[model samples]
Target: MDGVRFGEMQTSELVVSSRANARVKQLRAAFQGHARLSGGMVAIEGDHLLEEAWRSGMVLKTVFVSERRTVPGIVPRGVEVVRLTEEVFGSVVETQSPQGVAALMVPPVRVLADLFEGAGAALILIAAGVQDPGNLGTLVRSAEAFGANGVLTTPGTVSAWNQKALRASVGSLFRVPVVGVTASEVAELEGRGVRLIAAVGAEDSGVVAAREMDFTAVCAVMIGNEGSGLAAEWMEMCDARVTIPCPGPVESLNAAVAGSLLLYEASRQRAVSKVSGS
Candidate 1:
C-alpha cells in the first residue's frame, strides 16, 4: 500500500476540459474585443493568423483549440493553451468555418507621436466616420500595401477590432496600426505639420485629383462617412480636399476604393521620388 502509485501527476493537467471555465469565458469576450477579457491583447483566429503572429514574434497570451485539432508546433514558452469541444469553439466565434485555433496577442501600442517616430513617412489614412467594419478593414490593408505609416480613426468610426473587420483585414490589423482618437485630436494633427487631405464628394473647385498631389510630404488622408462624408469641422481643417478623378456613371467611389486609389497614387509618387532622387 505504501508503494502504490494511484495518483501520479499527469501531463494532461495542461489541458482544460470544462466549457464554463473562466479562460473560455475570457476567450469568448476577447473574440468580441472586450478589453477586460483580452487584457490589451489582440485576438486572432485560424492557423494562418496564428502562424503569422508566431512568425512575427508577437507574444501570445493564450491559444485556444477545438477538440479535433492536434498541436501544430512548439508553442512559445509560458503561453497558456486551451482546448475546447467543437461546439464550445463554435459558441466563441461568429465564423461558420472555424479553423479550431486562436490566439490572444499584444499588439504594438501606437500613438500620434509614433506617426513620425520613424524617418520619412509620407502618408497615413484617417478613417473619420467609416461605419462599416469591412470598409475600415479594407482601408487598413490598402494603407499598408500603399506604404502608409498607419491608419487612424476618429470617434464614431466602427471598430477595427470587430470580428468581421478582422476577417476582412486578412491580418492587416496586426500589420498596421489602427488607432481610434477623437475628432478634436485629429484637428491637431494638421497643426503638428502633418498635412491633412480631406476626401469630399463636392467642393468649390472640386477636390484635387490624386495624380497631381505630392504625397512625398508627410500627410494624413482623411476618408469620411459613407453617408455624410467628412464633418464640416473636419473639412475646414484640411490643407486640401482631394478626389480621385473618376470617369464613370457612378456618382463617386466607395470610401475604401477612393482611399486605396489615393494611397496607391501616394505610393507611386514616393517610388518616383526615390528613383529620381527629387
Candidate 2:
C-alpha cells in the first residue's frame, strides 16, 4: 500500500467528488478572493505553506490533500482531512506544480495594538501603491527578516491575499499582519505615538539617514508607488520625509529595494542601540 489506502483510515474521512462540490467551490472561491473566510479563517495552499502555518500555531480547520500525492506530514489530531482528485486539486491550487496539500486556517486576529506589545522601539513598513505582487511579497519578507513591527498598505495597493503576493511572500504574509486601509488611517498609528517617516524623491538631505535614526523610538517608514512616488497630501502627514542618499546617477530605487534598505537600517540601529544601552 502507498499509505494512501483510505480503507485503513477512519470512516469519517471525506472523499470529495465533482469539482462542483460545495467544498470544492468554496476552496476555489478562496483562491479567487471571492470567499473571505468568516471568523478570521484564511485559505493557504501547498504543503510548504501548510507546514509554515502549522509551525506558526494557526488553527487548522481542514486539510485538503490530493489522492495521488503522498500524505503530508503529521497534522493536528482532530483536524478535518479531505481527499481530492488530482485534477480537482490542481484547479484550486495557484502554482503549476500543486503541492497536493492545502489548508483552511484561522489567522490570529491581530490589530495595530497587537504589534506594539513588546518593549523597546516599534518598526513599521508603510507601502502606498505597490502594484506588483512580487514587490509586496519581497517587502514583507524583508520586513520580517529586518524586524519590522508590521506592514500597512494603502487603499490603492494590491490585495495582500492575492495568490501571487501570498506565493511570493513565502509565508511572511502569514507571519506578519498585513493590513490594508487608507493613507489617513496611517496617521492614527502616529496619534498612538508612532513617528511617521515618509520617503520622498525630492529631498536632497535624506530624512535622518536610516542609520542615523533613533530606532529606540516607535517609528513607521512610509514607501510609496513605483511610478508617481508619494502623493503630496500623504507626504505632508509624515512627521518627517526622508530619502535614501544615493551617490550613483540612478534617479531612484525600486519600491521594494528602497523599503528593504530602510527596514534593514532600522534593524541595524535597534541592534546597536541594544548593545550600547542608549
The per-model lDDT (C-alpha) reads 0.78, 0.76
Error of 1 at 82 (Å): 1.3
Candidate number of the best TM-score:
1
Q: After superposition, how far is residue 50 of candidate 1 from its true place, in Å?
A: 1.0
Minimal lDDT window, size 10, model 1: 2-11
- Give the residue spans of candidate 2 off by over 4 A: 1-15, 36-41, 202-208
Q: Write the per-residue lDDT of candidate 2 for residues 1-278, one digit (tens) a residue.
A: 12223333321344565687655666777777774533335678887788877887788877778887655666777676678878888888788888788877766666767577677677888888888888899899898999887898887888877778877888888788777767667878778798888876555554565555565688888888899888876778888876777888888889889999988888887788788995
Model 1 lDDT vs. the true structure? 0.78
Tens-place lDDT digits, model 1, residues 126-162 = 9998999999989988988888989999988998888
Clash pairs, model 2 backbone = 207-242
Go through the candidates in order and give the C-alpha RMSD of each one to the true structure: 4.6, 3.9
